[model samples]
Each structure stands twice: as C-alpha cells, then as structure tokens.
Target chain A: MSSSTDTQGTGAYAPALESPRSPYRRGKPTRSNWELHGWLFMRMSGVLLLVMVFGHLWVNMVAGEGINQVDWSFVAGKWSSPFWQTWDLIMLWLAQLHGTNGVRTIINDYAERDATRFWLKMALYTATLVVLVLGTLVIFTFDPCMDPASTLEVCRTGSAG
Target chain B: MATSLTPTAKDGPKRPVGTLYRGREGMWSWVAHRISGVAIFFFLFVHVLDTATVRISPEAYDAVIGQYKNPVMGVGELGLVGAVVFHALNGIRIILVDFWSKGTQHQRKLFWGVVVLFTLMMVPFAIRHLTFVFGH
Candidate 1:
C-alpha cells in the first residue's frame, strides 16, 4: 500500500497543482510545561503537608498532656521555640500554595467569560496573599506576655494575665 | 399569546463550551482544593481566636476549650480533621496530574481514587481524635 501510494504521487503528479494549506498551525505558545510544574508542586506540598499536619496533631493531641495541654500557655510555649515556628511557617506556605493553585486551576476551567475568570482569579490570589501574609506575621510576631507590668502578679503564677 | 407563536432556538453542537472545567480531573481537583482551603481558613481563624483567649484569662481559655470536649464539638473536630485530610490527599492528586504524562487520561479515576482514600484515611483518624477528646 505504501509503495502504491508513492508511485501514484510521483508518476501521476500534477505539477501545476497547489498544496492545501493547514488550518491549524502552531497557534499559541504551549503552557503545558508550566502546568506540569504546578502539578509537581501539588504532590510535593501534599507529601510535606502530610508530615507537618500529622506532626502538629501528634504534638497537640497525642503527646505530653494531650489535648488538655493545648491552652494559651501551650501555644505560647510552642511558639517560643524556633522549631515550632518554622514548622508552622512551612505548613502555612505549603498549604496556601497547594490550595491556591488548585483553585486557580478550577477558576480556569469553570469561569466561562474572560471577565469572570479574571475577576475570580484576582479575588482568589488577593485573598490568598492576604491570608498568607497575615498568618506569617502572626506566627513570627506572637507575644505571650505583652502586658508584663499590669499583669505581673498573675503572670508570675503562669495562669492569670 | 405571543409566547405560543415564538420558535425555540435549536441546540447547536454536542460539544461543550468554555475553557473552565474542560478537563474533568483538573476541574474536580480544583473544586476539592477550594472547598478545603476555605474550610481550613475558617478553622484557623477560630483556632487563633481560641488561642487568644489565653491572653484574656486562663479560665476563659479553659472554658472555651472545655466546650470542645463535648460530643457535638467532637463531631465538629472530626469535620475539621476530614477537611484537612481531604485537602492533603487531593493535593497529591493535583501533583500527579501535573507530573504524569498520562495524567489527563487518568484524571477522573485518580480524583475519585483520592476521594475514596481520603474518606478511608479520615474515618479512623477522626474517630481516634474524637475518642481522645470526648470518650473519657
């Protein structure tokens, strides 16, 4: 069949005939590579989230005094250490990115109109950015003993203020 | 009277419209992620506020948390746990969709698979959490 087609094309060719133009050329730049990177990020973040989330749970719910131990003092004590602060920071960033990218994909898929897609994405990104910034700030700027003077008597006992 | 004489527009093509949700797997992954994200955000807000109670007074903190020791709150905790678990698991699904060559083909299957796995994993974890908190 291949030989017959070759012979037909060569021997019976009309020299004056023009080739048909393709309707679909390489149109727009491909975005698949960027998408692939996003996909990879989801899995890596998910795996890391698994560890960070579970570790958080274990420490708060399973270890030491268990759930009862999780009070203001408990959080204050935990955040006082750089270890817990860093852990929380990692969790916050990973979860935000994973969640944001996931939603961005959704918005791209569901929002039909260009304006709708643009607005929704703008809102999503804005909200994500705000929350991430606020959360990181809180984690780093946390102060357990703010009113040290007025509440010194109570603070001394590790209960009141 | 005018309504009865009007002709209806015929359905155009069988093909769906819009770039949004064109891929089944990608669409669903996007959905689960958003749902989970909102859930986590609200949860974090409450958690931070709850922790802030300690700043007010220890008794207030204890009282707020003491309420969480109840059955209803235990159930709520389970819901939170479920949200976290589903979000984390589906995140893996999103990652697979990105990295795998055949990910598009298997997207639907993988999405559902992650959902099933999330439910399976969360059941025991949630139960254990509730038991630890309220079973006493």
Candidate 2:
C-alpha cells in the first residue's frame, strides 16, 4: 500500500535460487533428527504409495470389466486373496500415516497456541487411528459367505467362505 | 551483504507495490503440492470410511459402491486422478530437491518438467477413462 513501483516489469527477474540456510548452522543448535527422519520417510513412502495406489486402481477399477464389475463379491474375492489383502493393507497404512504427518507439519507451522496444536493433532491422530483400524479389519476379516445377507451366487452354496 | 541491502531499499512512498505471483516458480510449486496433498489426503479419509461398508451386509455394501458408477461420480474420479497425479509427480520433484545436490539449482526446470509429464499421462488416460464411464 505504501508504494507504486512496478519492479516486476521494470527490472530483470531475479529468481531466488539459494536454499534456506539450515537452522543447525547457527551457534550450538540442539537439533533432534526427527524431522530428518520424517523428511526421508515422506520420499520413501511416496514412492511406494504411487505404485500401490496406481495398481489398486488399475486392478479394481480399470482392469478386467472396470467399475461396473465391482460388486460386493468382487471385493470379497479380492480380500480372500492374501496378496491383495497385504497390498491394500500397506496402501492404507502408507496413505494414512503419510497424510497425517503432512497435516501435522501444517499444524505445527501455523497453530499459534500450544493448546490449539495439541488438540488439533490429537483429533487428527484419533481419526487416523480409527480409519487405520477399520481399513485393516476390512482387509483381513472380510468373509463374503459369512455375511448373512449376501446374495452373490458364490455365497449361495456357502463354500466360498 | 549488509551494505548492499541499503541502496536497494527505495524511499517509503516509492517502495515496491504488491503484485500477483510475487513468488517464483518454486513457491508456487510448493503451494500446488500442498493443495494436491490435502486433496488426496481427504479423499483417502472418505474412501476408508466408505470401504468400511464391507463389514456390513452385502446389500448395504453394494448400495454404497453402486453410486460410484454414476457418470457424475466419474467426473469426481477424474478430479481425484488429477490430484493424485500432481501430488505424486510433485512429490518426486520435492524428493529430488531435498536429496540431490543439483536439484535445488534446477527446481524451476523440474517443475515445468513435472507439468509436461502430468499432461502426457493425464490426457490419454482421462479420455479412455471417460469413455468407459459415459460410453455406455
């Protein structure tokens, strides 16, 4: 509001190229390595999530007959296989934990009060725990025939259980 | 550095005015990365809840997933794919910048590279995906 200079057009664009100086570079910084671990984990899990998520989408929604073919039995059949179960379980864990950590970073950066940060992260962790438990149970405990109301033909004979 | 900053500072009234996109490509890329990250995060949140229907009866589970087949939801699925692709691609770019010595120097170039790659991957994939959803 104080000025009218249009340096954007008048001067050559000088891109900010240098990386920010590390906090540890200053005098006697007592640094814990937790953030370093988190940073590395993001990259590693990102690589894995890309593969698992894409493959999950491909197999469940894209390959074979695609979405219309996805029924209760389709899911039951998938969970019945240990490989697919593990695939889904890993994907669920990686996505949830990675996302939770990402939001945690945001919360820490912006939340001004200790109580606000504490409560927000507590809520986030609770939701993440609930989802993780639910996803894990769905992947592992799934039994199509065991569901009493299943109308799928595979469940008719009760042998699919 | 202290002496150099003094001459660059214009008088109070003549100072630089705010403009759109004052930040460079890396900052904009960071903004996009967070937006896409949160999109994918919330999608997974809802998706996990939806998948929990598997614990319910088959009738109940089918009732939930059946809506996803609608063309309306197909459009949402496309948006989901867009978020996922951008997040993943930019996630890689960030990884490079963090761990590679040369990556920080070429961060802007890396961002444009990601945008081009995203276009290449999305266009054909989206066309084919939509054909399946609405073609029937």
Candidate 3:
C-alpha cells in the first residue's frame, strides 16, 4: 500500500514498489510459504556450510603436508573412509542448493525480463544439477583400484586400495 | 495542495521508493555481504567440477588440485578464504539479527563485532596461508 504510493519517479537505480505477496494479481491472499522456507534454509545451510567447508579446508590444506601432499593417493585415502565421504557428500549438497537459491534471488531481483529471468534460472539450475549429480556419483562410486594402467601402490590391489 | 505536494506514501504518488539503507557502514557491509555470497556461489561451481575429477582417476584428480599449488592460485585461494570467512561471520550476524530478540536493535554494533571477529579470524589465517604458499 505505502510502497505503491511511493513509486512515481524512474531512474536506472529505481526499485519497484513492493509487489503484493500473492500469485493472483487481484485475488484472495495465498500462503505459499516458500519465501519463509527459503529464508530458514539459508540460515540453516549457512551454519552447516561453515562447519563442513572449514573442516574440508583444514584437513586438506592445513593438516599434515597440506596441498602438496594431495595427490591421487591422498584423495583415494580420504574417500576410502566413510566419514570423509559423507562429510563431502553433505557439503556438496548443502552448498549447491544454498548457492543456487542465492543466485536465484539475484536473478529474480535484477532480471527485468520474464524470459531472461526464466532462461537464466534454467541455466543456473542446469549447472547446479550437473554438479550435484556428478559430485554425488564421484563420491559414492569412486574406486582407486579401478584403473588397470595405474602404477600407484594402492591401485595395485583390488581390496580397498 | 499542501497534502498532495507532501507526497504521503500511501497516496499512490507517481514515485514510490522502497526504504534504502542510509548508513555508510551498513551500506558497505550490505555490498560486501552480497559480493561474498556471489563469490562463494561461483567457487562452488568450480570446486564441484574439480572434486568430480577425482572420479576419473587418481592421477587426474591429483593433477587438477595440484594446479592450485601455484602462487597465483595461492593468492586466489586467499581471496576465496577471505570471501568465505566474511560470508560466514556476517551470516552469523544476520542470523542473530533476524532471530534473536535484541539483535536488530544493535545490528550496527553487531556488524562492527563481525568486522573485529573477521579480522581476528582471517588475519592470522591470511598470513599463514600466504606463508604456506610462498614458504614452499
């Protein structure tokens, strides 16, 4: 109400009046609850991301020999453990979903054209889906001993090398 | 005429402007918050792909992550750390402000607290991370 009355001038930086929180242009009030859900998700995911991401950085780059020690065998060793695998899996899922939703908000706010907004979000979701699927597969399906041509000590054996 | 010219917000005036942040600190903090968020989002894209490389072969995965060992990439890593730290700290501040009863009232003070904590958390980290990269 107040926002509608306040919108009169136009400029490059001009923001739109607050749109009524209803899908129907002039119908009954709707309770999609999506905005609330997204708000809560961002907060929850932020806390989890802090722990997962920092732990990841700390283990991979801070402990032991740091980044230099990270090689095929290093990853193989880590992924061998169920704890690390699940940690990574949760990190991957939460970060992707959280980041995708954030970008989606930006798109909705800035992309004025409906078609542009739709296509851009489509691309974002597509990229996110690809990463999520590929990362999940890589985490769960990885096998250090899968390669025959590999000369690594671990790859020589078939038993959880 | 006086009432009309006064432009009461609910009068459906020709121009409706939503409330915008006026404080300099708040504005800058808001900008940094968004930037850090976007940066993390972009990093996640690459990080996923890089991590996925592990699936190919140990050699492939090792080689991919190894590329980040360089000084240039080290600096980029520092930037990434900065973004992450800022985002996380600021995010906590935001959560407090939104959820805690007294948070919004002292949001300005809380922001400064974030900055102080950020410095404490990240400064030593940046120094160490850089030292690790260059010391090698």
Candidate 4:
C-alpha cells in the first residue's frame, strides 16, 4: 500500500486515513417483477375497459331507442343474452382489477408503516373481493322474471306476466 | 491536542434528512392517475346508487333515468364519459411505466400520447353518445 506521509500541521503529524471507498451500496431486491406484471395488467385492462365501456354506451345510448328505452325490462333483456352476460363479466372483472391495482399502488406508495400498510391493504382487498364477487353473482344470477306473487308490482305487470 | 476518530461514528448509517428523491419519472403521471381513480370511484358510487333506484320503485327509477335525459345531465354524462376515457387512457400509461424499464425515459411522450389518444378516441365516441342519448 502506498502511504503518503505529509507533515504540514502544527507539529510533524500524519493522520492515518481510511481507504477511499465507493458510495454505492447493494440494495435489497424488490418484487418489481410482480409490479411490472400489474402494470401490464393496467394497460390491458384499460384497453378492455375502453371496449366494454364504449360498447355499453353505444348499445344503451345509440343502438335502440337510446336512453329512453332503458328500463328494468331493458336491463333484463340485456342480461338475458349470454353475449351481454359475458360482456358484463369481462367488464366487471377488468374494472375491479384495474381499480384494485390502482389502489394497491397508492397504498404501497403512501402507507409508510408496515402495520398501517397491512391493515389498509386487508381492508382494500376485502372490500374489492366482496364487491367483485357480489357483482358477478348479481349479474349472472339475476332472475329477470321472478315469481310475480313474490316480486315487486312492476314485475307483476300484465305485460311482464 | 489529539482527537481520535471513532470508527463507529464513521460507519454510522447516514439517515436521509429530507424526503428521499428517488430518480423516478414525472410525478404528475402518478398524481393524474390517482386523481382520475378517485374521480371514477366517485362516479361509481353514484352509478350504483342510481341503478339501485330500480329496486325502490319503478316510478322512481324512471324518474332518475329521466333526469339523465335532460340537456344539463346529458352534458354531465359527456363529462363522465370523458373522465372514464381519461382514466382508462392514463391507466394504460401507468401500466407502461410499470412494464418497460425504458418507459420512464419516454414518460412525457407517454403522457402526451394518452392525452392525444383520449381526445381522438373520445371525440367521435362522445358525439355518438350525445346524439344517441339525446338526438331522438
């Protein structure tokens, strides 16, 4: 090791100095790959949402008598078709995922404490799961023509009956 | 006078004093995405409530739907459509940032791309939406 001994202080002095080192340090690996997947999901979901949302608009607003024609019957009719069912299923799934991922990212960025992050995410995930599952169930399991006797008066209309 | 340097002090962890500046891409994109998400969420609440009107009373349901038939509400629908369009478009931008390592490099471009695409896509769709909803 080449040592520079310089005596230029008040007395003849050479302070031993530690070797110079690089400031860069190794960082812990992040689950950024998963985040990357989620990112891709947002874009794909956005594209799908565009289609579902626009198609929904066109059908509800322009295709038929437009907004005036949309009623309980109209919804029932739409839900009756397997095509609309699938469309709605896709929309629900994508929207939930897109929204959930967005919130997840927000929580990760803002929740500084581990406990806070955990609880917030638990709540978020719980709400998301409940809504998504319930929505999907409602869309698919909806009985347009329920028993008139047990249903609302509107469902018991002569035309409906 | 002799002052000894302590190894522990020299090796002590340097705590960041202020907000750590992670060399990330533009913060505006994140902020926009967040704002749009919140906006969409707000609309979602209203939408679910409005749709739930059907369960209350058919007359009430029809009344709510009729409210949407007005010119003012029609304009509001246009704005809602715009919000969804922007949020979806910006969401895609956020996704691109997540997947591509080089995405941060083109953040400005991506942001502008989303804006342009949103406008182009939304214009025709919006016109069709308005006409369809209110034209007849």
Candidate 5:
C-alpha cells in the first residue's frame, strides 16, 4: 500500500490499486427492463389508482348512506351493471398488482436473510394469486339473481336469464 | 501485522456517522408512504375476501358488512380513508419529484402542500361521514 493522506476521515491508508490485466469476475449482464418496467408501472398505475380509488370511495362511502349502504344487495346492484363490473375488474387487477409489487419491494428492503426474504415473498405471491383469482371470479361469475328472494327488479320479475 | 482503517480519538469530531435522511421532510414522507402502502395492501386482502362473500349469499355478506357500520368501525373507516388520502397525495408528490423540472428544488413546499390538502379534504369528509354514521 502507498502512503497517502486520507481526505474523508478514514486512516492514512490509500485506496487499493488494481492490475489492468485483472480478469472481470462478475457474471455477464442479462439485458432486461423488468425493474425499469416495474418502476414505470408503479407511477402509471398509481396515477390511475388515485382517480379510481377516489371514485370508488365517493360512490360507495361518500354518496348516499355511506357505510350503511354497503350490503349484499349493494354488491349485486353494482355488479349487475356491465360498466361497474368492468370498472371493478380493472381495479382488482391493477390494485392487486400494484400492492403486490410495493410489498415485494418492502420485503426486499427489510428482510435481510435470504431464506426469510424468499419465504416471505413466496407467501406474498401465494396470497396475491388467491385474492386476484377469487376477486376476478367473484366479479365475473356473480349471480345477481342468485337469491330466490332477491328484491332486485330483474330478479323479482324473472327477466334475468 | 494487519493495519486497521478505523479512525482514532484524534481523527476528527466525536459525532456519530450515517443517518443521512434522519429528521428530513423527504425522509418522513418516504417513511409514511411505505407504511401507508403496506397498510392499504393488507386491507386489500381482507376487502377482497369480504366482497367475495357476495357469492355465498346475501345474508352472509350483510352479516359481515354489518360490523363496519357501527360507531367504532366507523371511526376506523375514517382513519383508513385518511391513510389512503395521504398515500395518494404523497404518491403524486413523488411523481412530480421524478418528472417536474423544479420538483427537487420545491419538494419541501410540495410536501407541505400535500399536508394542507390532506387536511382540507379530510375535514369535510370526516364531518360528513361521521354525520352519516352517527345521525342514522
């Protein structure tokens, strides 16, 4: 090691010099935009979610009777419409993916041990899969008239097929 | 003999190092964003499950949703909305920081703007929502 003055507060040891002929030990870089796309997706989906979530809160909680208005009938009424069905389907997908990715980043940051990080991420993926599939199915296969005693106009009049 | 690079008592100031982000507005907002995001994510799982109860029966769905209408859960709902609002507002701030030309320079102002707006919106919402919950 060469004798040198330390500028930053460490001892007088100078920086290590490397041989120009030293072979690069790092593995080849796999060209990918996965992380970049994930970053962009967060920003784009976040903007969309800000609008959609506000609309959702306005419709469900801020309008009419607020939380009291939420019930099975309310769900049936909203899903009965093709527009809300589509709205919710998109929301389900976007929100689930956004939330999953956000949590994955947090897991990466906090879970120091490799095994812990892997298991935690595995659990997160499993739960996300279940919620996404179940939520989508619920929206698609919803039988608004499933209840024989349903008071909905379509259900009561037997117009629903 | 191995030489260590650790600084001695005569090296410099005795103050501790690191924590570059401590006590800064940017740091606090980042912390809040992470926290609120995690909270919202966990809530989403429960929300999806509750909504899925619709597929079971109307009676089943109402039975569960009924729990949220009470005064206690009503207040909890207010907090949840508050968290959502904060997260959403700060998220926009983060976007501006990334995209806007002067965003980094005025980030502190933007954070205060987020705080003010959050308060302005939440006040009316809390009043209206509480009225709905309690007046009924």
Candidate 6:
C-alpha cells in the first residue's frame, strides 16, 4: 500500500505504520520471546535488588560503626552464618544478571556497527561470567577460620568462625 | 532527491528545532536513571574483585578495604551511594510505569516522587556515613 503520503521524501509528513497489535505474525517468533522475558526479569529482579542492596548498604555502611566496622572479622562474622551466605549468593547472581542485561541494552543502542556491538557484548558477558563465578565461589568456599593465627570467636572454636 | 534524512539549513522551516522529550522531567529522570545504572554496573565489577581478596589473606583484604576508609575513597563512596539510591528509586518508578494502568499518565509526578524519596533517604545516609568516615 505505497500511497502518495508514503512516497514523500525527507522533511515530509510520516507515513502511518502498522499497528503493534496487528494479528498478522511477522515471520515466526524468532527470538522465542526472549526480549519479553528479559523485560519482565528486569522488573522482578529490580524489586528484589532494591531490598537486598539496601540491606547490604545499611549493614555495611550505615549500621554500627559503619564502613570502619567492615573488616575481615566483620566479613567472617557475617558469612559464618548460612543465612548471610544465601543472602549474598542470591544478591550476587541477581545484581550481576540485572546489571549485565542493562549494559547489554545500552551497547545495542549506541554501538551502531555490528562488530562494535558484538565485541562490546562479548566483553560484558565475559566480565559477568567471571564476576558471578568468583563471587559464588567466595561465598561457598569462605572459611572464616582459614588463618591459623585467627582470633575470631568462630576461629577460636575451630568452627565456621 | 533527498538522500539524507539530516535536516540542513537549506530545508528552512522543515528542520526540526528541538527534541520532543528535551526539557521535560520525564526526560531528565530517564537520563539520570541511565547514568546511574551505568555507574553502578561498573562499580559492581570492582566491588566483586575487591571482595574476592578475602579469599587471599586477611591482611591483604584488610589492606585493600582500608583504602575505602581514606578521605578520597570515602567521598567516592558517598557518590556511589547517591547513584545507587537514584537508580533504585527510579527503577521502581519504571516498574510502575510498565505495570500500572495509569502509570504513563502520571509518570511525571512519579519522577518527582522518586526525587523526593531519594533526597529523604540520602540526607540521613550522608550524615551518618560521613560521620563514620570522618569521625575517626
């Protein structure tokens, strides 16, 4: 339906495009609704991140003596419990994935050239994988009593410390 | 034949004057959200790396983290708190804009609400955190 209006050159009134709600399927759903799912995940994960991140900030930067209290012993005290371990593990995964997707969107928008876009995303994904793995391992394998000269309560007991 | 969409002075009145979203609260909030999100993401990478130092040795971890207690990094932490606060609040606004039926209609008002909430939360945090950082 190339009407006269549709044939206008630059600096002319735009032609009306097809409605997004149109029933006609455009070449079988290719990406398998990945974009839709990503959109939903951003919202869902965003809400969770707000809570976890705020709690983290409060505990580490606002409570007690604040940042000064955050030392190896402080970390040992927190991670010694399974609860904080789980809290941190989930927080790590959610925050990383959420941030990665957001950066991926930015890369797609600004990196006009295909090679630039591809390499940017490649770097992002690589960093994401590394961070996730390292964070996870740290949470799981953390041994508060690893140091023989440690004097933490848990370390003194020769336990989680 | 107009081969390029770029409007030139030759086009006269046909050239667009300004963007539709420029100078609007919604636009500003959107810009702030993007900037904050990017800043937070980069910080997250550094945070993870620094935290991994715990696995090395307590002295190493303590030495590295001690840098944050310095005045320079203390101010940097304040800035980071500002970014995280804005991104978190604005993200909730975006969630409402997407899910609530009347969200788009009130998006401007919601952005202002985000600003107000950010200010409220940050004031105490700044006072408390700065005290801890500088008190000792």
The per-prediction CA RMSD against the true structure, in angstroms, equals 10.8, 14.0, 12.8, 15.1, 11.3, 10.4
**Model 1 misplaced regions, further than 4 Å:** A1-34, A146-161, B1-38, B41-70, B90-124
Best-to-worst ranking by DockQ: 6, 5, 3, 2, 1, 4
Against the hidden reference, what TM-scores do the models get?
A: 0.60, 0.79, 0.79, 0.62, 0.83, 0.84
lDDT by residue (A1-161, candidate 5, tens digit) is: 23334556667566557558766566776888899999999999999999999999999998988877888888888988999999999988999999999999999999999999999999999999999999999999999998777777768775664
Top-lDDT candidate index: 5
Docking class of 2: acceptable
What's the chain B TM-score of candidate 2? 0.82
| lDDT for each residue of candidate 1 in A78-122, tens digit (9 for 90 to 100) | 776789989988987887787778778878978999999999999
Q: Report every candidate's CA lDDT.
A: 0.72, 0.82, 0.83, 0.71, 0.89, 0.88
Predictions' DockQ, in order: 0.24, 0.40, 0.44, 0.20, 0.61, 0.62
Which candidate should be chosen as best, given TM-score against the real structure? Answer: 6
True-vs-predicted CA distance for residue A54, candidate 4, Å: 2.6
What candidate 4 gets wrong by more than 4 Å, as runs, is A1-37, A113-119, A146-161, B1-26, B45-72, B94-107, B125-136
- Assess chain B of each prediction and give its TM-score: 0.70, 0.82, 0.81, 0.72, 0.85, 0.85
Weakest 10 consecutive residues of candidate 5 chain A by summed lDDT = A1-10
Candidate that beats the other on DockQ, 3 or 4, i.e. the better one = 3
DockQ, cand. 3: 0.44
Quote the lDDT for A128 in model 2.
96
As a whole number from 0 to 100, the lDDT of residue B87 in candidate 2 is 88
Using DockQ as the measure, name the better of candidate 1 and candidate 2. 2
Query: What is the docking quality class of candidate 3?
Result: acceptable
